[model samples]
Target: MPHSNTSQSKGLALPPPTIVLVHGAFADASSWSPVIELLLERGHRVLAPPVYNRSLAADAASVRSVVEQIDGPVLLAGHSYGGAVITVAGAADNVAGLVFVSGYALEEGESLAQLQGRFPGSSLADHLVYSPYPTSDGATGTDVSVEIDAFPSVFAAGLDSTRARVLAVSQRPLSADAFGETASLAAWRTTPGWGIVSAADHTINPDVQRFGYRRAGLRSVTELDAPHLVMQTHPEEVASVITGALAEIG
Candidate 1:
């Protein structure tokens, strides 16, 4: 049977919400590929949208635009920096709930830098490579990415070395400005939420995930003994968390 919600007044079944998977910095929508495939096989409608990795506000706006266009309710699950993006974007009226997968769940007025700084254990800073990119205004802006050689260890730990290397070379870079920009709104503050903490994460400290999720008062929190790329290394576990959230939402 298809997943659905019950209408209290009409005795009708509302269609299951479309799941929107948002990838974090240093990755694209493809980062959700493993989990996406699993979700699809389980008869769920999913969309893994690209995050521009520009500025928090811009990225959140871009995601919000996508959510706004969906026909029914949306279940947003974000990984890494994408968690921050959805923290802002999930405020949409159609957004029914949120899932944070090895992600940073920021509070209102908190910047990614602020949140990560508090935990102080991520190896991501040491492995980051910054390069200058020209902005639309003809100004030079900094783009931050994981160093290719170090990406496999720092970001994709536990994945096949060859596959990790490919991800390293093809990684998307996030704007340096995104680190300092404060989230104007925290959707998790209002929306029902679920979270997953990659206990072995090196990109973002597991403590950071725990802290944010606790503050958000999420409905459920799962801790996985996985690395930063939990979606790839533990797709089934990640999918289970999402489907669990869906079941509860229904």
Candidate 2:
């Protein structure tokens, strides 16, 4: 392939921006494993930081820390509630773009709880199981989890029951407050963005996903028929979208 003058000027077609992936509630950084490999194969630097689902502010701070430590421009991607975290963290100086994979892109002062019902396709409320825990201030806090039996139907409908069962058993619960806490900034307002909206998503309504993308003025969107765990179920599709965002911003 012949190189463009732009590539020569940059010494090597400006390498793809580093990708920082943020996993959502009920899942850990491992959820991004498949996508991570795909991105790596394509010669992209990737990082997945573990987010403490205690509060939006705390989660955003964690993501921001990762973004800051990255040496160059960053492409920030988030799944599920992690979308909300990136919405705040993407405001960092290093972030070049945002990618929302089955994520909620809240406006300033909006929250996951508020966005969950905005389009009303979620069946999550019906499948939740709550347990009490101690908070930082020593007060009681409620942690919400999905019923193991209902996990396949509500969060990973496309996966086999056996696989979904394992995921459910290993799932991490999020603090009830994380969902209710309001976001202070909407990074999508200033950052270029891309979205992967899962058509069969029951965790975060598909229509709501569209609404979020539209609200964020995303550069483009790729829709998949997979469920909420689209990245796990269709890693190639999700990886392609991330690479697409890199190309768009580059």
Candidate 3:
């Protein structure tokens, strides 16, 4: 399922594509600001909504709400945990393409637990992960979350000192329960998609991201010496990948 030839040209036509931004755990919608801005500047409409930001279902519902506002085809994109959220949200009729920014792609019968289980010692998760809570955010199960220092060390690994600090403070704490939800659909398998591999990422290992990229059978793939937050660490490069995907799917 690997892509054959990756051209920087145009292909199919989606309904004036509306790019939806879904942020991973410990972050809100603003996590995609730079990338969203880049795409918007390029004449595309962007929808970066603040999903439940913690509750997986709530986040998916937020994505659905945004999708409802748009008129046609959408390039639903998610970062980190947001990837899982979009997998469900994009199942709708209008999702034309998908983008995973150092995000996870769950298999039809798998959950985040099983996928991460495949890469237990990935440097990315070891450093950033916090212990699951007895009742995180009022939940009744184990819910591991991130702390401030680990947040930057893992997520903004490629960011400048200033930006990383800002991201740590701005990060939102998602409900620990979101990761446990089983992904009901294999969105990547059924949809055209692409992934941006952050070579220097600390939150999610570069190697692991590549695994997802390859397994998802992306239309095209690109790697960058960016942080886990490639959207913020390398905005233009991230946008260019999206541009590349748009061209291929034009």
Best by lDDT: 1
Candidate 2 is scored at a TM of: 0.92
lDDT of 2 by residue, 1-250 (tens): 1122345456764444789999999999998998999988978898999998899999999889877766567899999998999999998877889999999999999988888767665788889999999987889999999999888889878877887888899999999998889999999999999999999888988888899899888999899998999998999999999988888888
Candidate 1 ranges beyond 4 A from true positions: 1-14
TM-score of each: 0.94, 0.92, 0.83
Error of 1 at 52 (Å): 0.8
What lDDT is obtained when candidate 3 is compared to the true structure?
Answer: 0.72
**lDDT ranking of the models:** 1, 2, 3
81 Cα displacement, candidate 3 (Å): 1.2
- How many clashing residue pairs appear in each of the predictions shown? 0, 0, 9
Query: On a 0 to 100 scale, what is the lDDT of residue 248 in model 1?
Result: 84
- Pick by lDDT: 1 or 2, better one: 1
Task: Give Cα distance to truth, residue 47, candidate 1, Å.
Answer: 0.5
lDDT of 3 by residue, 1-250 (tens): 1011111123433356677788787777787888888888789878788766556666777787677666666788888888778777777666778888888876666667677777744554554444554444575554455667766676677667887788787766665567676776777878898888877766665666777778878887788877777888799988887777767666
- Residue 242 of candidate 1: its Cα lDDT? 95
